[model samples]
Target chain A: MKYCENCRVSVRTGRETCPLCQAPLKGESEHLFPEIKSVYNQFILFFKILLTATISGAIASVAINLMLPESGLWCHYVVLGVICFWILLITAIRRRTSIPRGIVNQVFWICVFSGIWDALTAWHSWSIDFVIPCTCMIAILALGVLGKVLHLPPSDYLGCILADAVFGIVPLIFYLTGVSQFVYLSLSCVAVSIIALVTIFTFHGKQIRSDLARRFHV
Target chain B: MNQIRTKWNKLDNAAKLFPTASTRAETHVFRFSCELTEPIEPERLQAALDETARCFPTFGYVLRRGVFWYYLEESRLHPEVMPEQRPLCARLYRPRAKTLLYAVSYYGCTINLEVYHVLTDGTGAMHFLRTLVMKYLARAYDIPEENLGYETAHTSMADDSFRRYSHRAPIKRTERPNAYQLRGAKLSESRTGLIRGTMSSRALLDAAHEKKVTLTAYLSACIIAAIGEDMPLRARKKPVVLDIPVNLRNYFASDSVRNFFTPIYVSYDFSRRDGTLDDILAVVTETFARELDRDKLAEHFCAFLALEENPIARITPLHLKDIVMRTVYHNTIKGYSATLSNIGIVRMPAAFAPYIRSFHVCNATNKLQACVCSFGDRLSISVTSCFTDTAVQRRLFRRLRELDSDLVIETNLLDDDA
Candidate 1:
């Protein structure tokens, strides 16, 4: 091992200077462990470049729109769209540890954003009719399939699916209140949610109750 | 998803602040490492950890946030032993999770036990580490499980001694201006640079005897003098305070494996007196004598408990409480320059001593900290600091080297100049 005359300590690794005093080390040193690399680090440069480009593009578009009087305030849509996209992307990356939870989060956010975008354009009811119900239906199907493919226990995906099912059932209110211009997708989503809930109750009733108790236990 | 109710207990008085104060930069986790004569067997160590985890039920729980406060609930999730990797004493307890609060990992011959401060204090953690080493050695060598003399009953070991000893008295609170803070560039990637020195306990004890003061007091004085040397001229008006955590087990008879200690501040002002080792030692010894009283220490902790009992604090939601407690932690921690905790001597049976080399204890901090514990004749003083500069640590260790020229040191910091 290398020794530092100044710090009077033996350096275990091959670093040329003392860790404390920064004095030059003498003699050979040893390796402690293999170098570590984080998975996210490989894409860091790419992410940085992408972030710079997106930010610059947004700024340039807004600047050009301001410079030209005929362009109108359409750049606001681009800014808000970019912000919402990044928010959803970051959330998905953070929740990537659990696939079921990430799927549920994505389904919820995508439906909400599409609804907001549709409302911003006009009250076309596409958000409630197609986007909301379709997102919920796809989420239910994806969760059911992923549970089997990933070999997840009922405790892992039951709560997430239950949440999505409850959200899916909300559009039935739109149908009953005559807020939805189209009824086929909303009715289909409600049917799928009821079926999913009944299946979970029949198969994993005890697990759901126990999971709730553990989560809410004070 | 079994319907079994998990066992949990309230966070002790000293422990309540740590969970909120903890962040990725400065986690309130400390590590206890034991180097053996040979490399550890992965399978045997895993079996030993499972056996030891069952023995200490409080160590098996995880931290959870409730409506009003944060509590510990039993977790059926078994914490598997892995190789050490992350920066020293990184955050172990993330909120809203059901993982074990303590982790066990091995690197070469070292068996490291890192625990969140909310789970236990140094004394409590020492007991757990001792038991874990005993179990590992017994299994490794096929020795019969013998009474290592460190084992305590789970019921009393998990007792909240601070609550039991709290007395309802009008508390007096003394406020001091913030001490001179250590300013330096932090280490890269938030890593703590750990440098440890192992020397003869008798030699260091004799040096303390020559000073006519206790070992802890002598070391505290040395630390104060070290910081005093580096303080700017304008900053000398504020005292250089050393925060020392006193183990309450020495005064009160409680076998709590949870937190049960209080910190006493020892301030030595260089502006008033000449900054010498003698001057620092005198001030430290006087402060220790004045503050170590049983009733005085009780009142100090009871004052802390008073805040926890306030109706407003009680009614505050955990989210709001986290913010308030975190602010309080930041402001209160600034009151001290550094912390020095001496766990004192670690004694083991003769049968197990031969297999063990030594034991070390150190904590993570944004500032400097020295954790001292001895095994056999070796006094292991591990200095863990977050700063890139080593002026304070150099002075502290060099002063120690003057006492014994045969001091041997080991460290985990990689050089930047390399």
Candidate 2:
């Protein structure tokens, strides 16, 4: 009912100007499409503030270390620590949709970072002896419990459990190579891994095989 | 261990590129909507959608990532009918999530069906929207249900027609020069801007008959002329190419509701010839004659299928294949200036036609795209573009206005100075 003299076409919108030529329309109008509001993320400001605060903290630590040389080059560690924090935060945020995948990812990253941190501090081997084995064992148990409680499909959590079991076997290599000074935790981790693998293979063999076949199809 | 195994399907040959190349800016989601004379009743629409979903079981599948290729796995997610709240053609497939690839929403009198390209193409989506409208009308008005004949069998509806029609032949590759590209500031948040013009189909068909060309060819020529008017003198060396997608079901026997279309390029150099509507139409008509041949189109599609069938390409890991496919998609798009898809006529039963106003089709695109679909005498041509500049749209509509003075336009854009 609204006609634009410039474009010579009738428009069915409630706007004053023509959509094509921006000329004033000449009649009454009716709505054809609903007006959609722009999407705004409120957490954007929170993330911006967090990023600024971390960068300033790293800078301030470096400045303080330079002023006091006796601090013995500790500022580089602060910078690396900030970078490590971001890596972990990003990984968690990216995998937040899938709980099983997130747990598996967190276990891998936490063990790797703890090993590096322990090496930097000293050759205590606490990361290999305690952190790696304990994290792997806890992840395997948590996945099993959650799968049962949540009633997730066998295809969903079975693969994560298998992955964690494989990770659980890593401490065996550490125990054999003498990288782990205390042997009890690593041996227990190995025992738990073998038991979990046996249980899954005994019961959910078909599900795992189909899942693996589809995933690794090439 | 009493679990029923979920069925999964390999991505069709044309579907492989969409999962890799689709971005937030270009979601590769297309929409088909039916506007009834009466305001949509949500409960009846929901009931209708449930029945339609039961008919097309493939629409219930979700996109999943595999090591070698992305596949569609059957899921139990039920689609609900809600008021339209998101921007037009918003992103439907998110990475690492389990969700259906299509959505149904309503606004005022219109029932909108938005589908990701990986699920099906325009023809399939049109069939779905028609069925939903019919079912809703049948329930609401107490009209006897009439069968809108389509392949309702599960096996045939889910068939992979690309693999079925492709005969193993030597692949032919032709080098194409890059076409002219549109440049302008894009809409914020990567939203698509749609300007649809509805007019009498009989008038346009008469004009095409007078010109001795098909309606699609005539419209392509008009679009080429419009783009040519805006081209700078320096960019005249690059030809303006229009990529037209041909529905393979027309040339071959198929009952699939999945993707089975291939694009054929029609490029016209304004510098080489006088830039007029007639000149452009002559070029487009000739190109259509050569490209629309059965053997030529078969060769064209088979060449593409041969790449997917290659031993090395089949064995390559999906992550690496994603990188290569994404690169190829970007490069291939650069060879075309724009896309014009004519979904042809949409038919509904006579009993339901009294409740329907018209049907429209459009898609999200990084560049400009025009989608045409007709219902009754109403022909809806929806032009969608990411760029803020509307000169090409302005010229295209002005040209169309000359053919019919009863043109009616509608847009989703807001007034800036208001």
Candidate 3:
């Protein structure tokens, strides 16, 4: 038997919104609490699935290897991983996944690529540095030139790296001069960390401030 | 100058507009002042003036950078030239007389940089003032050129300097709901926004000390509560933010005065209704102490100046520069609701001190501007509204006295002066 004063809508007393007016109900200030209670919640879920799959795959591969040492059982596990990945990828593609979820999926694919690349290179006794950095550079440049926001040009990346390097130059100079290496590196790292922190903060700030403006009726 | 010119292509459009665009182009009238100290000498004044003029960056042509106008090459005595007057339009080598006390207010006083808001901001003007004094002191009193001041290969900027200027420097507590219609009335004229008492510098200090915060913080908190009680709309948040300008000289050491200080905006959400004069001070004092780290300050100083010294923009037409400066002004996040500049305890070297027994800080913009400055415990609360909104200015001082029951305020700016 609750009614909104402005909207004249009947709503449940304890509910957080009016049925007709859709006005936020009183005591619903908790709505301001961020939706994610913990970012670890995401990692935990991902970790659980990753651990289950990796453990099962490794166990199956080890069993097969023990049964037949001559046969490459790791190849079987790799095929199984591909199958599992396709299932998840198809599910993600079919449903409109959150941007963050999509990004995490993309990162997972990159990690998978790195893991397989490392394994293949290790098996062949080949160095990955010469190939990896160059491939990444070319790929990133192409992606950036293609207008992908995530893939920054090599020059732009180098600019940030150089900026970070210059930020550390003073402490680096002090270290190079044999003044306390520990302190200089620690200070230099702090300077490097600030770039990440500010970039992330402003990215969030621009969004948060915009949201605030709408809420505050600015 | 050549270094600046050589780096012209590297400069951005925003930097180009900084000098000329800084003039009160958006508002009604622009007002600013610079104070210089002299080393009690009459003989070396002329040399000091010439030397000071030569070294100061402000001495060169302003370029009317928005438009392609050149006055530096123009004849000083030409019919159109008023070399002594402050430039109404940019793009001129309007040489300011480089004497320690160039007084336009008094005779033998010149209308120099001190009188020109166009040449610099309060921060920029202060640098000129400090350098002018330092140079004069060194030359006249035979102080070393180092006393004239040497630039650090890179000066260590104190964090206080790079602080984002407050948009609405908040100062007050307990605002009421602003349900009443805001008809062309300035907020100051509203009955809800009046000072109830009078407190002198010493008393205000004593009050703040009792509350464990400085004078500014205490006054701001008290005002916040009063304002909160009046502003019904903002009750959703707590620990309302209060932006206070802490003079950089107090926190960091910067010999060059051009914008050496930035105002730190601190928030105090009174959501708990647990607001007190003391709680507000606790947070403010902590922030005031911590925000002025040297590295942060230096970065801000360099970044801000770099923005100002941008050469690419410098080469653009002044009209375009003005347009860009206007946009930049609009985009900025003006830190607080109101800013309080406490130019504490003015010590006017006896000679000049006698002529002015007391002074108050009153700065009004043609647009939405509100700022208060205090010296020797005397507070000046200046609010600017549209020229059409005359009622706002009339009620500002009166309402301020209304909020504080023990405050005794006097103003000559209201009726008689005009």
Candidate 4:
């Protein structure tokens, strides 16, 4: 299968040009991952890379903490894990391109998002504790760009952001009040992230249902 | 929502395009009844009507850009006008007849004449009109349908529609296609105008056949000549293009529910230009060759879409779009000395043969419109223009009668004095 760049039409396998527009393919089908596939493909990739990167970061931080007991560099490792997580998410949605194109697209969105986070923290006079959930909140909001390219409606993506803010941050609030151990805080954040992300993906699936029904009279 | 929109996104961008300008302000209904040499069978007649509709599916096409040649939807069956409010929009209203009335009802007048402008020219419609009547006759009369087919034989190639019909001079261009200047060109001082004329679709066709020319080419020459004689200032431009409507259904290999047409810019300039009838026929034939080409029509349709996107009012600046639209409305209304739509001759059943002795053609809500139709032996040419000059109309009829010698023209003038 291939995708028409101008109109975003899908061409069947081995087709020379898009039947509707008659434009030739520019080698989009040869790649392992098409820019637009099932939504599950995107979610799965992010989930896998996110697990890989974040778990390694956590293990490295634990090792550093045991080696230099007074250094307490685990905070830096967690923050670095989140930033890499952000970069990985943006690249998944952008067109399959050369390393430079991928880097450019990824970097542009990352800076824009990071800039908004910096401004919001400065305005609210938020502490380091707030930054973790705030970074997640903004990334959730940025999912709209993906939804539009995929022609999915905004409702579900917006719902995901709301869920992340409520579910991801409320426990942080609970932890800030000195209610739980550090292990529970980390576990709750991971659990909340899973639930919010799952809900967001499902909401988009509903939008797809209605859009498909309208087109086919199904 | 995501499931459906995802698939819809895959349809051609051309499928999503729609018309500008008072889109569907008038309805797009068309009807034709036929009388047979034998008594009509209701079922057979209905079957024939279906075939007639199948041929001219352009009623299914939609307008994009300035052309009428695009349809992208899976289903072309637009929702029928709700019976309740249908009366408010059109003055000519009728109660929904019985279920069997579908045959006749489907063939009633097409309301969306604005889209008609870009489709096959009136002469082309005349061919469709004739075929429709024949289809009905073949089914009702038990005659073979295949034998009633038509051949598009073009002979006289290049001639102006007006000159052979009327001895009018060409108008000179006072300005170029720069800023639209027709906004200030409204007629302030009233001139005496009296329009009286009649045309038989059969007679026009016969006249073109006699001269070996297409009906559109024949009438177009007369129209150009009339402009040359009537408004010499506006006739200076040579090789003028007419916005001849081409029915997309007959031409394009796509669904016919939307707008589908292209303009034929028939050139009026003649190499051996003479006022003789032979000279006129020569020019008309060649001019038609220059204007009518299927590929050019398709390209024109694309250009129209690129120039203007879908014109839904919510997202677009309505006030600005209207202002721009007004310029097009004024210039075409003014630029062309006049538009002549020969809704050529038709044959209807003897039942309807009584109520509709003669039918006329009028498009858009604009009073400046002019259309002529012929049924059987009866022909009527009608002009609906603002009450500016009553005498120009009188001159029009006078010249029309002088050319044909068998012209029977009548009119209903909407002037303030009356």
Determine the C-alpha RMSD for candidate 1 after optimal superposition of all C-alphas: 3.7
Q: For model 2 chain A, where is the 10-residue window of minimal lDDT?
A: A209-218
Docking class of 2: medium
What CAPRI class is candidate 4? incorrect
By lDDT rank, best first, the candidates go 2, 1, 4, 3
| DockQ, model 1, C-alpha based | 0.26
Model 2's lDDT to the true fold? 0.91
Which candidate would rank higher by DockQ, 3 or 4?
4
Off by over 4 Å in 3: A1-218, B1-63, B66-103, B106-118, B121-199, B234-246, B249-252, B270-276, B299-325, B333-335, B366-418
Q: Give a tens-digit lDDT track for model 4, residues B283-342.
A: 768866764666555555554444443335223443454456556555643433344554
lDDT of each model, Cα atoms only?
A: 0.84, 0.91, 0.38, 0.41
Q: Can you rank all candidates by TM-score, best first?
A: 2, 1, 4, 3
Each candidate's interface RMSD (Å, one decimal) is: 4.1, 1.9, 28.3, 30.0
> Between 1 and 3, whose DockQ is larger?
1
The top-ranked prediction according to DockQ is: 2
TM-score of each: 0.87, 0.97, 0.39, 0.40
Candidate 1: stretches off by over 4 Å: A1-40, A67-72, A99-104, A134-169, A172-177, A183-218, B1-13, B64-73, B93-99, B167-174, B309-317
User: Residue A188 of model 3: what lDDT?
Assistant: 39
Candidate 2's C-alpha runs over 4 A off are: none
- Candidate DockQ values, in order, are 0.26, 0.64, 0.01, 0.03
